[model samples]
Target chain A: MKKLINSADTILEESLDGFAAAHADILLLGAERKFVRRRTLKPGKVALISGGGSGHEPLHAGFVGLGMLDAACPGQVFTSPTPDQMIEAAEAVDTGAGVLFIVKNYEGDVMNFTMAAEMAGREVASVVTNDDVAVEKSTYTTGRRGVAGTLIVEKMVGAAAETGLPLAALTALGEEVNRRTRSMGVALLPCTVPAAGRPNFALADNEMEMGVGIHGEPGRRRVPLASADAIAAELLDAILKDLAPGKGSEVLLLVNGFGATPLIELYLMVNAAKRILDSAGVAVVRFLTGSYVTSLDMAGVSITVSVLDSKSTKLWDAPVQTAALRWGV
Target chain B: MKKLINSADTILEESLDGFAAAHADILLLGAERKFVRRRTLKPGKVALISGGGSGHEPLHAGFVGLGMLDAACPGQVFTSPTPDQMIEAAEAVDTGAGVLFIVKNYEGDVMNFTMAAEMAGREVASVVTNDDVAVEKSTYTTGRRGVAGTLIVEKMVGAAAETGLPLAALTALGEEVNRRTRSMGVALLPCTVPAAGRPNFALADNEMEMGVGIHGEPGRRRVPLASADAIAAELLDAILKDLAPGKGSEVLLLVNGFGATPLIELYLMVNAAKRILDSAGVAVVRFLTGSYVTSLDMAGVSITVSVLDSKSTKLWDAPVQTAALRWGV
Candidate 1:
């Protein structure tokens, strides 16, 4: 793989080191190198933590700061972080209010975070997000594979946590956010894992992997490449079908790129998505378009629609200051 | 080319439509669809206007909002925007303080912006940025090519403009920013224009282009791909050679991805850059890493180092909320 990395074995360590240095003002290395926590913790505020495999950057680690994740435990690429990493992160960031771990719905992630919560003697709560409607079963997951909707959950839950919600309330809020969100993704190119040194899957130039998972897991089916509008219609239809928003209902839209897609294309996809939503009589109250969640150099786009109530809208619009997403701070 | 574009002919217009729709709160389509301006302008604030060929997503357009450009005129893919578009944008954004046009140092850009300023029929000042130290001449220019350093100019001058700097002062400030900055880039892969449906340049599987321009122009030389550390060292060394930063001098370092490179690689590069700068006895007072400026889908990075005094540092730290870059607000 033509990647700008050191030795493949050192990729994780070096990347973490760089991430720590780049965001030193808001984050610091946790007790263990595999985790990162906020530089300062509020004594009575609920601490929010989320993590998964390392490839989906700006997800867990990049969100570590004020108004977002208090701590993040990143695993090696596509591998789950050990329970010890999660425990250390939780212990380090848990204020008297308690700690909440937002785990994506993957078997390894769910199990390890559960173990970490059990190991942590302090008050700990966990919320598992399974908002990806693309697949009910995948290589690394059972039921639904959590995908881009995790970003929405993190933002809303982080905002709610910042309001001094207790652990139980915060966990319930996270689960509610997950319940109201749905996501679907399409991949034009499979990403190469540095360790593997090749693409995880191969496809002809004219074909695309629809409903592909973040780690190149199986999706609905392979299909011939279509126009951006068609792809947008398909992904948006899938998400709205799963969401089933009532007419004139307001929704927050997220059109995310899978790493390699450029902003222009994301904007194009956003246009298509907006048109589709308009035709469906849904009002896009707020929209975010970019690579908020990403695969490792994968060329694809994902559409996520979250049905929003007034409280959810307030939480979503709340100020956030993080490495990747920031505004109104 | 494998891109998520519907058609080359409509890509620019559609992308602009999406941008306008997505950022409606902060931006509005100008008299002509070719230009976009901030939704509201501060009365008597010196307006900053910038534009260039399309494909450099989030450069000029995404920088428009709050304490940045008042208007942006996007051209066709890899083509200079017309004088008429600039005239319309300038007329719409100019309030009595006059407008400062920030043009990149390309023949077409310079000539067109010049015509637009003359036709503006208002007090107008223009500054052309040519901070790329890669080559004195390239496929599109007689002098140095303007690359990522334009971002530094816009941000600092934008802050200065918000402080009510007059047309002449903002123009001079932009010129000063261009003077203090130097940049060099390396491309691992060439980008393809959607219309062309092929790569702009060719490279062997194991080779990379050093000192490459944003538009895939000829660089200093091509070399076999090296490790991330080696690549970082090479790029930083060239920029420092051109800059010749004094010992203990404070600098703002920008490690910009050329669109397709992921954050992980850019962070890896930041680590390498910081180490090199620390060893060189130069203090990095501030730094920004991400794809602030980009070629459509090129896999590459550019390093910009700008010597900063106290005033420049304050300007850089000032709050500016735009779609692409935001902090300290």
Candidate 2:
């Protein structure tokens, strides 16, 4: 694999430096060599901190702005952020209002964030996002694995924090968002991490994997790579069956582009999803058709749906301001 | 190639529906199925909007939160968003404050966004981001084509808009940010769009493109893929030599992972960037690492640096909130 780096050891630090330099508006404190936080700390607003492996961009850090997370600690290529890094992030962004930790349900992420929350001397609340419909939801050693649902939890809970909602409220809101959401993903080809300089998993030229995780973990099932429509149906079927939206049920649909799936395919999948939902009598009241959370360049797509209700829908419509996400209508 | 799709024609609408389902907080409206905008509009906040091909996730949509863009219209995979979509985005996101169309300086994106801005009823502020240091700045076209630098401009300028900065001021700030920034990229293997479901460009067991674009556009130069250190040196040397940060100058660095590059590799590149800057005596005040803007599963990365002054640095510290970017210290 062709890469541009002086040395493997320096990629993370240098990348952080460059990212921080680009957005000085957001403070990129490298105190722990892996933590990033907003420069400004709210005096009384409960700080919301989230972190995990580093491959997903615009995720934990891209979201460090108003109405979102206050700090993010990034781990190595696909590893969870360490407990110490999370602890520092919590301390740096925490104010009198306390702090809230939003963690995806990966075992390592959960353990690390939990450790950080426990270590923090200040008040803290946390909610794990385990909305992935692809998982058995009960079979994983770590419980339902958190997938792209983290984005919704972060945005909604981040809004609560921005509004000075208590940490308790934010925690509840995070869980609420998770309850309303479910996601499932599939991969066409394994991605090659630059550091590894090789494919994460080898598939024949014509194979695909279903239920792929963000780190290129072995998915639940693998089959011959199929056509776009076939892939879309497979993904949507997994998602819809898991969600089981009733007729006329409003759903917030997200046809997420995995790291490498093009928008064209995403849109095509969206079309397929609509037909499936329409035939099923589900109405999509909302949509977010882009990459929110990504697996590093894995050629696949995921379908996420949040069965909407009044409170959740209202929260979704609430005014929010952040570096990467904003909405108030 | 394997993919799932009934047809390409209906992909966008279906995708939009899914997108809306995921982000019910953000309003979605468009009859022709081309554009979607934030639910909240700040009248006269100089609505910032951007769009282009769809494979680069979060470029236009993920940036729809506060400190960034007011809206983002998506195009088909690897194809520029249609001009009609751009026009609708302009009309939908436009407040009395007028609109600023931020184009990434691609031939197609520039043409489409420009026409849409001109066709719209309201006067609009349009700016092109062309900070790819690898693409030689040229009067021959515009300057260097925009890449991840567009993300920086979106964040900083979006913050300026949140402050209710006037259109002229917003334009000026965006321009300043654009002027101070530079970027360069490289790719190991070409990525395949889901619709195509195959590599866009051919690569042997050992080959790389030195300055590829998000859509796998041929880069300025094609060379034998080098070591991460050598590649980083080559990419940064061009940027440093081109940008030429003077003595005592400070920079905001952004080492970006194009779709497939992992954080482990990003850190190594960051080290080289620091060494290059350190040797040149350029101060690194802030940094960001991870995939901010990505191509569809391309195995590559980019580096961006914004030479900063005190005012710009302070703006970086400003307390602003958006969905994807935020800070308040």
Candidate 3:
């Protein structure tokens, strides 16, 4: 792969080094360098930690700061971080309030975080998010895979944690956010892993993969490339069918890019998505358009909808001061 | 040609609609839908206005908000906006403190903005940024093309404007900021202009275009793809040659992606860029890494270095709450 990396073996450490150097004021790299925690910890506030593979940047690390994640333990590209890494991050960020692990519903991530919590032996609680409506079983997981909706869970849980929510309440809040969120993605170009040196999957010039996973895992199926409006309709139909929100339900829409997609295309897709939602009598009160969760270099986009009520809307609108998502204080 | 756009002819208007819909709280679309302004104007504050071609998003329009541009005029894709659009934006944002136009040094942009400034009967000043160190003349300009450094200019000028700097003082500050910055870019894949229905240029599988412009303009001739460190060194070497900063110069570095590039690669380039700057006896006080000024879906990056002093550094660190770039606000 023609990536701007020194070596595949050093990609994780070097990238972490870059992150540490660029945002030293907001993130502190642990001695092991596999984990990152807030530069300063706030006492009596519940600490939020989330992480997974490394390729999906700004996912865990970029979300670490005030009003969001307190710590993040990033694994190698597409690999799970070891239990030791997670434990270190947990120990570093945990104050008197407690620690919450926001885990995506992936086999490796769930297993590793569970081990880390057990090894730490602290008042740790976890919430697993499985919001992808694409497939029941994917290449790496038995059930549905976690996707962009993980960002919503983190935002809501982080805001609630800021309010000094106890461990059980915080966990329940995260679970509720997950239950209210659904996501679906399509890929126009496959991403190349630095180590693999080739695209993970292959498609013809005029073919596109619908409901594709973040890791290039198999999705519903390949389909002929279609116009933006048609593609938006299909993705939105799948997501709305899975969500089944009531008429005139308020929701937060996220048009997330999978790495190689441009903002122009993302914005266009957002336009199409808004049209679809408008026709369905859904009121998208809040929205974000960017590459929050991304595959390494895949040219694609994912649509995420978080059905929100009064309480959930308040939490989602709460202040967040992370590298990726920031608003209000 | 596989883009998430309904059609080439409608892409610009539809994307602007998406931007307005997604960020209604921060932006207000004008009657003609050719420009964007802040939702609420700050009376007596010097207003900053910028305009250019439409493809480089989050540049002019996304930067319109508190502590940034008061308004932005967007032209057709890769084509400069007409004088009427700029005049409307200028008139709308021109408070008693007057308006400052930040123009990129492209032929059409400079000409149209100059005409608009002349048409504007009130106090108006303009600063044309020409910071590209790649070429003296390119496909669209007679001199160095404006690149990502324009963002730095807007940011510094915007902060100064918040202090109620007069139109003359704001113009001088912008010009000084432009004078101290230099940038160079590279492209791995050419972007497909919506109207063109194809990529503007071509590259071989193992080849890369160094110093490519934001409009797919040719740069210092292409060479075989090399190591990331080597490429970083070469780009930095060219930029430093153009800047000629003395030893111990404190600079703000920006590793900007040309759309369609992954954050992983951008971060890695930042890592590489830092090493080169550090070794060159330069101290990087601050930096930003992401897609700032992009060319549709071109897969590449541009590195910008602005030699900073105490005054400029203070302005650079000021709060900005735009959609694309925001911190400390």
Candidate 4:
């Protein structure tokens, strides 16, 4: 296994210490490896908490700040934070208004955060996002597990909560966004898990996995690699087929690059996506092209589109300050 | 060449289309693939513009918004954006206040953005970040060119600019931040650029390249693949040897995963990094762990430490909002 690290055993703790130092603006909780906002709570404002494994940069951690998630708990890489940790995070940040947990739809993430939510009880409301269109209904797993939809859910629910929406409203909005949003992705090559120091799976140099999940999971279908234009066509066809953004309906476009996919490729893909959408007559009002949430280093890309209304668009435009996923009107 | 993308030609445009649809709140010029905040520029605020090749997911584009760059132009994967594209970005986003160009240490990025800055003329004040410690002083290239230091300089100088700091003040603050920061990274495997949909370079499964820059450039040294613990030790030792985050000094630690590293490994590696710092008695105040900036599916990690002071600590604490980075009080 090839890596550039001092000692895997002590990596997390030391990294957290440095995290605290780099971000003195936030209160660092070493035990949980969390970066909490310095301001404990805003009177009458609901607290927002989000978490996931560590490898996906700036997802849970980056989204902690004003107009976004209040606190983000970090777990071991690719492993969900323990139930107790989430409960602790809930208790630590919850105000009178309540707390909202935005969880991606992974079995581990779902189970852990659900347990945490149950422990949180009336203290917070947890919303699970299962917006990945890559997966169809399955007997073993829940239908359409969440991939990048977590970002949409986070932005939407976070804004609603910031607007002083109660737990019920926030939950409703989160669900609505999930319902209206859809995401799908593919991988050029399997990522190498550092601890293991090996590729999760061996993919041929010319093969690409379609509908890949974030955790190095196999996609629904695997096929020979194609050009960027063809990949955009496939992904856009899937997304449009799933959501079908039509005339008079506004759409929020998110072109997310998995780790290792360059911005130029992402940019080029977005351009191809536009041609696809324009030809389809989809009215795209807002666009975001970058890696918002990502799997470790998988050479792939995911496209997420949310059918937007004025309210959701307004919330999307609201100023947000967090470690990741921040933009505002 | 292994990639998930269907075709190469249309990747950027298609990706942009998908991004805009998903983030309808943020307006993007569909023709140009530029990302601007949904909100109009406040009067009297100078526009801060930065951009580079497309592979650096959120670097130039994702950092567009309040308390950060006003606009970021997207370039082709691993290649700089055209000067015309940048000029358009500058013109569209400028709000009477001259724009500021933040260029990274790459020769292509520097050269291209430099041309754009000149084309932009007096309308923009450009500052370059040349702070990487790995690339030593040499007549062959700009000495120790910028790596992650571009981010710190942008955040600090950006915040100051938002607070209406003079251009000179912003430049001075940027230089100071660059002075205090040092970064060292390694690459486990070479990335396959979308255009060249195959590995740029080869690495034996047991080998690791140290002192690597973000692009798939040559590293200072290539050595046998070591355990994460040992790799962390070598990286931190090199970074620490150069940075010397001493016992009494406050330092912000960064355990950045190159693509393909799992968080569990990052966690373990971060813990390893902490012990090293603790043994040194560095007054660690902050730490950031994740894939903040990355090379395409490069299975490695980088350790960065910025010696901090009250001013920097406070500013670092100040809220920042971007897709890849966000934090503030």
- Top candidate on TM-score is 1
Give the candidate number with the greatest DockQ.
1
lDDT of 2 by residue, B52-72 (tens): 877676466756765667778
> lDDT per prediction?
0.89, 0.73, 0.90, 0.70
**For residues B155-261, could you state the per-residue lDDT of candidate 1 as single tens digits?**
99999999988888888899999999999999998999999999999999899999999999989999998999998898888888888989999999898988888
Docking class of 1: medium
What are the clash counts of all predictions, listed in order? Answer: 1, 92, 0, 103
- Model 3 RMSD in Å is 1.2
Kindly list the per-residue Cα lDDT of model 4 for residues B1-329, writing each as its tens digit: 55445566655555555444443443454355654442446567777777777665556655666677777777776677778777888777777877778887767777888888888755767677765666674222466767766777777777777778766667677778877888887787777676776787888877777777777677688888776667667777777778766568888777776655644446556666767777878766776666656675566777777889898877775766665565442
Question: How high is the DockQ of candidate 3?
Answer: 0.70
- Cα lDDT tens digits, model 3, A92-144, are 88997888999988999999999998998788899999999999998878799
DockQ of each: 0.72, 0.29, 0.70, 0.32
Measured with C-alpha atoms, the lDDT of residue A291 in candidate 1 is 85
For candidate 2, the per-residue lDDT at A252 reads 77
TM-scores, all models, native as reference: 0.99, 0.71, 0.98, 0.77
- For model 1, how does the per-residue alpha-carbon lDDT over A1-329 read when each residue is reduced to its tens digit? 67788788988888788778878877898754869898988789998888999888878898988788998998998899999988888778887788899989999999999998898888888889988999888998989998899989989999888888888888888999999999999999899998999999997889999999999887899999999999998988888888899999999989998888889999988888899899999999898988878898998999999999999999988888888888878
* Tens digit per residue, CA lDDT, model 4, A148-173: 87887787787777778888888888
Model 3 residue runs over 4 Å out of place are none
Could you give the candidate ranking by lDDT, starting with the highest? 3, 1, 2, 4
* lDDT for predicted candidate 3 compared with the true structure: 0.90
DockQ of 4: 0.32
Q: Specify the highest-lDDT model's number.
A: 3
Higher-lDDT candidate of 3 and 4: 3
